[model samples]
Target: MPWQKTFTLGNKRKGCHLITNEVVNAIQDGLQNVPIGILHLFIQHTSASLTVNENCDPDVRSDMDMALDTIVPESLEWTHVDEGPDDSVSHTKASLIGSSISIPISNGRLNLGTWQGMPPPTVATGGARSRNIQASI
Candidate 1:
């Protein structure tokens, strides 16, 4: 049987955030007995996305945000500017990264790399805001 649930991540400024603990805590109950399975998470917004990365270093998160800004600079001319300058940039960044992630489960735990973690709500509205995430196990 598959287990599912929804959760919210509080708002933060424009940058990558380490959300592994938050996500795991929210879906901990569902992950308890899954000796072998997969955990899929989807963010319910276009402005923000999901990704796993090195959780040990704060620089990786900050650098990710910086790299994204470089990849999708706000100075460029964008057709979808209904919200503001960062609107289009935000969406583009989300698209470039993605809105979902899946990880393997082994012995009732996520089988991720030693240093890997489900961090970063990639981008956010106005470059930052709360994000709703749906988890399926």
Candidate 2:
């Protein structure tokens, strides 16, 4: 049988942060019995996204945040001002980064590259908020 669970992560900062361990911890119990399967993770927010990338270096994360800031600068003129300056750009950044990911589960473990892990994207919305994530295995 397949397993599914939804969990919320609270108060992530305004940039990419590694959450691989958190993800695993959230669904580890459900994953224990599965020998081989696929894990799909979906983030339920428009201003944030999910992606697998290098988790070894802190620079990689900072660089990504900087690059995205350049690519989708919050200073750009946008009509969606109800949220803040980062509003529309946040949506754009989320679209560019994506909101979901798939990973292979082998022997009840996530099959990811040595350097590849999940780093969630975030747009500085001026305040910290919760992010909902759904995991299916």
Global lDDT of each model?
Answer: 0.85, 0.88
Off by over 4 Å in 1: none
Per-residue lDDT of 1-137 in model 2, one digit per residue for the tens?
88999998867868999999899999998789789999999998999999999999989999999999999987888889667777788889999999999999999999999999899877446567779899999
Please tell me which predicted candidate would have the highest TM-score against the true structure.
2
Which candidate wins on lDDT? 2
Model 2 residue 28 lDDT?
93
Off by over 4 Å in 2: none
- Superposed on all Cα atoms, model 1 deviates from the true structure by an RMSD in Å of 1.3
lDDT tens per residue, model 1, 1-137: 79999999988677788888898889889999889999999999888888989989888888888888888888898888886778888888888889889999988788999999877635565545788999999
